[model samples]
Target: MTDMNNPDNGGHGEWPQQQRPQYPRQPQYPQQPQAPQGYPQHAQYPPRQPGQQQPPYGYPVDDAAATTVLPPVPAFDDADATTLLPPVPPLGDAETTALLPPVVPGAVPGAPPAAPRHRQPVQPPFQQPAQQPVQPVGHPQGYPQAPLPEGQPEGRPRARARHAAPAPQPAEVFDPPTMTLKRPPAPGPAGPVGAPPVPPFAAVPAQPAPPAPPAAPRGRTGSPIIEPGLQPALITAGAAALLAGGAALGQVALALVVALLQLLTAAGWFRLNGMWPARQGILLAALAGFTADAAVLLADSDGGVAAVVGTLGGFFLLVLVLQTFRPSDPKERFYALTVLGSATVVTALCTTLLVADWVPAGVGAVALATVLAAAPLPGPKQLGPVLGLVAAVALGLLVGAPVALGALAGLGALVGRRVAAYDWPSRFVHMTAGVALPLAVAAPLIWMATDLLA
Candidate 1:
């Protein structure tokens, strides 16, 4: 019966020729008591004998009657032997959730799914032994391979090569989870390309040294240091003596010596410890020397004006030298220059009298008067008085030539105190050069104008 139902068996109810057993058919009855002739024994079974029954396995009368009464089987074709199976149900939410990708929080829904990841497929769930955990092949005995969870399908290929290294990140960037990619080295020999060369340190020029500080103030000690006033007093006395003696020869010799000393001191080559004395004394001596020389040269002659002008020129030169070489104390320096200027005026007046034979009484008075007018201004406190003197002199000079000579002589002294505060050399150069130049041009003009006798 099982062989007849199997689709692989022959359909004609015949067993395979090679597999069939050869059996002899046994007659159930001796010809089945010979069916009544022509009545067709196929329609009726023979009557059974007492104590004898039908055969144990054979077509029966009841089965034949039951088949005749029942409805006909549906063609009894190949289709009747096949069974109908139930269809598979769709997946549930939990299964679907496991299969679907997790959504990023802010991403739009209903968007087309992202492109499939090209990675090696994940391993499928394995059929594990009921009580034993599956162990990885070639791994330690206790280290089991992590099995795919239940509810997954089989035969999924491994995801594509997602493990390939990522792109290299910049060094400055702070990567909490470090990137694993090994970047290719930047193109060539790692030398800086198109960059400015490192400048040779030797090419840089050295810086210049800073200037030294100016010299300290003269005669001024922060600690109240004592200084001798004798030099200044002696200087005043010597100037007084030269003016009073009036000896032409003695004056000329003294003045020449003083001029030489002054030049030496101004050059800084000599240090005469006479304090202000040497400078003041030198000025007085120079005045006397110039006066005496002019006197001898101009006596009994028309050259008295020349001698006077030349003496003035010498005095201007001396003032210029003093101004060019500044003293630490501007006040004292200008005071000394003022004394020299005044002496020059005195000598000029005296020349008019003694050398040119101008009347002594008048020239003496003029000389005395000019000397009184032209003196170094006393101090900062005396500025008002000195300025008054200056105005008075200017006023007098504009009125007469005699006063003009005195005004010129006194001019340097009066203003020198103010200008002395400046860089002495530069100021002195400017003033002396300005005055000397104009006078140089004017001297000849004045001589020509005055020389009516010539």
Candidate 2:
């Protein structure tokens, strides 16, 4: 066991190779964690208070671990020019504070912000806390009890305020409003209402139920939103009559037909409906028609339409331009244009019809017919019919129509007025009649004129 002379052996002046001292496993107090490197020692943690109890191994250091739980890293502020470090627990038991990752280097001044360090979630030594004593409601010393009133026992719960009689409710203080009494004189009034012996109720005849409205005419059940007040029929009648009269008489000419169609299309549909685009189209068309009419009349071919188209076209153009400039819903612009244009065209066509000739009288029979057709006869009773007949007769004779023609016109006008008055046979029926009747009346006259000329 003692090789004293050997250089490698354990001997005096040569310390022997020693084995690590093995001691019994003493109670291993959890090692405290050291302040992380690069962090100021002072910022790491405050010293533990004396007499503070340490938790058992693997248990939390209670307040010590809690204090360090939310690390107070310095704010990433450029003004301080300081590096932040997560608050490391005091250099003590490693169990209290697990070794943390090294402090992340902060951004150098004038550098782009450093990408944030992804920190591992600290698993706090979570344990249900020991039950603490129940705290007093207010101050720890306890609130002062109000002085007990006379006749009350001690510790009886104090009322928030001293009790007094409850204030009177409104109903108790003021009597409620009631229905005003119409009390009769005390027992003295067995009077008038009771005096009249009740007459037997006379038997009431049940009034006949009001007659149902007649069904809509067949073939036209859909709504009639906005048509000519007989406008379609009016056009057909006027167009057919114009064409027929022009063809049969040969003296009347096609200009009147053109004018009638233009008037009907513009005035009847477009203009009335507020179609601005259609109105503009009509104005342009009217201008063209005016030019054509002027050219034709100059050439002695189309004499029926006068240059009045130009005037109406200009007016309609102005209106449309104003409307175009006006603020309105964009969707309605086209319709508004059409309506305005059509109306303008119709008005111009009226002027054309006025100047246009059918039988060569200066006023023009076609023009007179056009006027009558375009106008309305809406007086209450037979007033329209009477006036219309008189006007027809006067106009017919004044315009040098035959007496037969005058009588025919009067009859036609009267019939048309009556038809118009009765709303039954569709609005178009009377309107067609109003426009067509004159042409029918004039047919015979046209025959007579042809015969005489031939």
- Full-model lDDT for every candidate: 0.37, 0.43
Evaluate model 2: give its lDDT. 0.43
**Candidate 1's residue-wise lDDT over 318-375, tens digit each?**
6658655875588877765565554344333333323321121122222232233223
Every model: Cα RMSD to truth: 34.7, 26.7
TM-score of structure candidate 2? 0.27
Question: Candidate 2 — which residues are off by over 4 angstroms?
Answer: 1-293, 301-334, 337-341, 344-380, 390-454
Question: Each model's number of backbone clashes?
Answer: 9, 26
Residues forming the 10-long window of minimal summed lDDT in candidate 1: 265-274
Per-residue lDDT of candidate 2, residues 88-151 (tens digit): 2222222222333222222223458646545544443333343342322322232234455898
Pairs of residues clashing in candidate 1: 118-160, 119-159, 119-160, 120-158, 120-159, 120-160, 121-157, 121-158, 121-159
Cα deviation of 115 in candidate 1 (Å)? Answer: 43
